[model samples]
Target: MGFRKGISILTISAAFALALSGCTSDKPAPSASTAPTASSSPSDSGEGGTDAKLEALGLDSNLKFKETRKITVEVYDRGNDGGTKPEDNFYTTYIKEGMLRDHNVEVTFVPVPRWTETEVINNYLAANQAPDVSLTYSYPTIQTYANMGGILDLAPILAENKELFPDMFEYLTETNIYWDQDPATGTLWALEGRLNVLNRINTFVRQDWLQKLNIEPPTNLQEFESMLRAFKDNASTLLGADADKMIPFSTSFDVGWRADHLTTSFMPNDLTDKDIYVNGFDDRLFLMPNYKEGIRTLNKWYNEGLVWKDFPLYPAGDTTEDNLMKLGHVGAFMHNWDYPYRNGDDSIHASLQRLVGPDAAYVAVESFPNDAGVYKKFLSGPIDRKVFFPATNKEPIASLLYVNWISKFENRVFLQFGEEGVTHEKLPDGSLKTIATTGEKIMNSPANIDYTITSNGINLGDPDLTVKSIANGYAGVDSKLIEIAHKITTNDGRIGKNANVGQIKAEDGQGQALKEKRDTILNKAVVAAVDKFDEIYDSGMKDYLNSGGQAIIDERKAAWEKTYGTETMLK
Candidate 1:
């Protein structure tokens, strides 16, 4: 669904870039005028004021629209594929057209080639041709851009335009740790889009095969191992010499998809060493005990042949694992809850039902208990996919009115789902359904309809609608998934709190060498401890903890005292 990162030179390069960007520079003091005021409508004049026409439109409250008489916006085109029809290409016909005709806004789509590097985009920006908005992968990237003054500090705009972007602003303030405020400057550099949670890393198994073998879905690690062995043995008996065709488990290790789940099962703690409680501080690298246990279990599983030996070499694009699962030869693997099969729309659940009747059931394993019997919880970051804007046209009142008009629920549904009678028709019941193309009733249609309209740069409609459409379906399929998703606590509770780190600025390349040296040693020691568990337990692991780990703890204590005026370390 998204790109993956590895422990490679690229990561090192990114760290170097962060260091060169002077992420540790102290934040400037907040301007006294930055405070919120009752008369702070964008129409008042100066950098923050807007015309009365725009003030009526609702643009005055949040955004300090530039004094430029005309607003021309630039955005990236992320959904273009070669052979895509204009209507079929949601970006072309819907989003751009809707914004121009309805909102009376001038916008340009800057289409970057798919799979282009970030450097290319950054270089374009450095040439004074950067789009008003751009996509980023992490908080570090946001910080880098903000440090270079390439991006806007969206906090004030977000605060003022709460009516238009209520859910989005709320989610950023309540859910995202990176967006936390800087205590010194009282400014937020960037807005967050979404968080990735553990629900997406579900485990899928061959329900049809389980029925044939009269095996129940495994609940715990012990039972899971037994089931795998049983499947292997049964396949050997059934297929004779071709028993290897019946793969008990298969997964691609290249992208770390399967590896993440296995690790999660063993070590359910939050993985990042960064202060899950603070934003801008040195990470507590390799401090979690469960990390070591997780790696050791993975090694054990690899040595025992429970996992496929060829996993390390598997190409991410190959569908060998999915093919085997479809053929009912694979017993288990890590996957999304719904796995695609040969039939385009058929999913893992549907395939099992077709192959072995309706008696088969699928189980989603969430966590495994340690010796203390506590179900260690593991969660990923929030989905940072979409963002909103405050209308900042010269006619500030007009912009606000436009935003308020669009914020209405009726307009939101239309913008998101399209004209009820054309793209979709309401069922006899209240629920909406896609219209039949050729009078043949279609149960489900592609959900990309809204993506086309919203992809247009100037449209600042509610993103919550999109989130609902994406998360609601799967959420209904399994409640536990959503429950676990909500429990995923960010490192910092919210963006305002974490923004404090931005106040501590640094010189170019000053933090680079130190960061590299720290990360290198940490990675080497952690990898060694995981790879040579027996030796590490006897020698390096204990010594490393007493030496390096304690030093990190001391550093954290000092940092905490400086930031919060407290000394709160155990040792």
Candidate 2:
């Protein structure tokens, strides 16, 4: 409790923490990591004198090594979906050149499958072939490696080289930088990436369908169910020839992710901090109290033929669910706040307008309310991704320097919004407007997030600027609609408490495997017969507990009690 923490472990309650700032195709083979080499002194920096010039521009050349320091960082490989190799695009090239010109660092990127990132990172760690700098969504993976001494303890390096990472420190701040600190030892293995935009999930319904049926948007669970029934009963009226194809509610194999708002709505609002930390093993709250009833509700809908029956059949990346939604066969569903407006011309909204009718559109709705009668949203904390250095990283300073350079305002802005008149242009009001581009300059990821490892979302260095730029980023979507959806995402949002307890050993090596088991449980329970819903769900949950769920719960509960005994630990 006495150690440096960004936010207090206790007193983190159901308050809206809103800061309105705010992959691809190639399947390129990963580059091999080489041995670490020594760096040259500032005086030995080559006759090109780039370091001196960089020094002249306010950079501390003394902080940089005179010789080139080579380090590899992990980048997600989405299999060329953005029309360029994920590992070697214009953005990656820019990063390599920028790091070299500014920090005398030669950077290479190692690509891992985006969807299967945990498995790939695990394999790399096990084989001792991980990139010098690694990034992952799963903090447990880093902890597991750290437990086995495969991760570098960044505390000393960061403390010893404070001047080298001022931008990183400023951007991430204490809350994110020390998010994963070991409570007992005061050691840190990873730094949390900052999420500028904090909006969570929302339920979306077809406004056109609602108008056609003359049914007002539902405001609660019972009304929501009734609305779904209306969609099913009037499928023939809405779809005519495609009535049979109409899925009143559509979701995928990852039910917990797609339908999270529904389950969280069932979670009791009075849950204690200890209760949340203990049961919050997976991202989904499937193991939370009353969550089974939420699954049972879905099962009831599934039996009545209101839910997507074939959802469980499709796996990740199949695109079956997306294709259904875009074709306008899906009446309503729950997903990210801006799911409909992404990807510009290729977005779901665009596809729906082209395939269905111009009048058809998925609009955000507020239908689910918790036991306390408030719409409770368990939003992600300020942290986004976990950035760490592998034990094999000999150039820890260089890696930190590279991350620091990326976190700087000027560098990250260019990465997010490319050259003017190309990827983006400045509006008359001084806000950035992204434009579609082709050829070598095309951005491989939205906002060039893949390359900006230390930061997430649009941060134009000011709160108002970030909010305006984000609202303007959606090309065809109405800015009003985006603003409304943004409000909905942060409505009654509750951030989970980051208890300063030491690593939960059970969670160290079990994130991915337990996630698979958890998904199987939710997927099976949703499609089971109504009479067998409880039985299937209970049995699957029992199996999940036996397969490491119970251990994580026990560890978290014990850790909480050990730190704060007999107290709810709320603000």
Best by lDDT: 2
Each prediction's total of clashing residue pairs, residues at least 3 apart in sequence or on different chains, is 56, 14
Tens digit of lDDT per residue, candidate 2, span 1-571? Answer: 1111111111111000100100011112111111111221112223335444334222344455566778999998766444688788888888899888887789999988877899999999999899988999998998888877778766544443344566887788867877777766666778889888888787999989999999998999998999999999999999999999989998888899888888888889988777888888788887888888788888999999999989989877677788898888999998888988877777788889989887888888899899999999987778888998877776666788888988998999999998988888788778888876767887666787788888889999778878888888877777877887888888998876677778788887889988999889899999888888889888998999998989989988899889888887655
Name the runs in model 1 displaced over 4 angstroms: 1-88, 106-130, 155-180, 194-200, 236-242, 254-257, 268-287, 314-324, 327-329, 336-362, 380-383, 386-561, 565-571
Residue 246 local lDDT, model 2: 85
List lDDT for all candidates, in order. Answer: 0.41, 0.78
TM-score of each: 0.60, 0.88
TM-score of 1: 0.60
lDDT of 2 at 497: 68
